[model samples]
Target: MAISFNQAFAGHDKMLEFRSERASVLANNIANADTPNYKARDISFDSMFNNEQSKLRLASDNDRHIQGNSTMGESSGLLYRNPSQPSLDGNTVDMQREQAEYAQNSMQFDTSFMFLDRKISGLKKALTGN
Candidate 1:
């Protein structure tokens, strides 16, 4: 019997990719906290999930391909955060907020990594009969 890893993984792989991408975006916001007019950006997991379900899946040649929903003026799940407190230089990134978000994202990433690791370990044990 052929073992389909995709079926076994159950979309956790994609979730991991999304989480990693979000981490990069959050880190960018933190890095540019002092830049004038730099709007803080974020990725919404809920919006991403909704977009995935709402569209027909397609095989794309590149990971950089803009998601299909972007053509319709949808934000493509990348959103500019509204700053709660305005800065003197017109920069929107709040260091404390960004740090908190990055920390939360990091924790979630670790949790997902653990889940994926456990799944792979279970599969390995099943295959080895150990």
Candidate 2:
């Protein structure tokens, strides 16, 4: 029987991708902090995860059928932010908040990376019998 990696990884890979995209969105907001009328955008994890999960899941015709695998499609979960302290320039990017979020997201990405790495290593050991 072929080893199905999707079950082994258990969505860490997907979470990693989501975190990376979120980082990009947050960085973009930071980059546009000075742009007039630029609305800061962010992605909701819940909505994005649901979107990806629905796409990744496949219908099982038989009780014991191998699942389908495919590239994860992009999601449109980006939403404009409502500023706590509105700026006169109509820019919604809050420097402090954006920085905080970016840092948090980086940490989460690192965590997911570590988990996936450990899982891969464990699988390798099992296969190698060493």
Candidate 3:
């Protein structure tokens, strides 16, 4: 009795998770903008998603292929600090850039959530024959 959503939904799930994490990081950067010597950190989802090792799934020898943990493990994207600008107080956070990035990430997060909601709604309708 295996019940699962379409494979397309998997991508959306991953994207939503990534975007949510990115938003948190961006928010953190913005919150610590005034903190002296505080370095801004960012994640590279493109590189993380592109990694082949992260996309790998366990293959069972028999027909019963039980899904296991992702090969990517608990590792997130690579954290990097911006090198373009440096504050006089040794802080690396650029408020303008961080605000823009945060706004963009928020929009992306909302979009992903909306898409997932719509998908679930569609499934509900289908199951209810409505």
Ranking by lDDT: 2, 1, 3
Q: How badly does each model clash, as a count of residue pairs?
A: 0, 0, 0
- Residue 13, candidate 3: how far off, in angstroms? 2.0
lDDT tens string, model 3, 37-107? 89899987776665645667777788777775564535566576765788799899988999999898888
Q: 1-130, model 2: which lDDT tens digit per residue?
A: 7889999998899889999999999999999999999999999888686667757768798978988765554557787888999999999899999999999999999999999999999999999998
lDDT (10s digit) by residue, model 1, range 1-130:
9999898987778879999999999999999998998999999988787666656655689999865543432557888899999898999999999999999989988988888898899999999999
Sliding window of 10 residues with minimal summed lDDT for model 1? 66-75
- Model 1: per-residue Cα lDDT at residue 98: 92
**Best of the candidates, lDDT:** 2
Candidate 1, TM-score vs. the true structure? Answer: 0.82
Residue 119 C-alpha lDDT in model 1: 89
Q: After superposition, how far is residue 15 of candidate 1 from its true place, in Å?
A: 1.5
Candidates 1 and 2 compared by lDDT, better number: 2
Candidate 2 regions off by >4 Å? 53-75
> Which whole-number lDDT from 0 to 100 does residue 93 have in model 2?
90
RMSDs, each prediction?
6.6, 5.8, 5.3
List clashing residue pairs in candidate 1: none
Model 2 lowest lDDT segment of ten: 68-77
Cα lDDT of all candidates, in order?
0.86, 0.89, 0.79
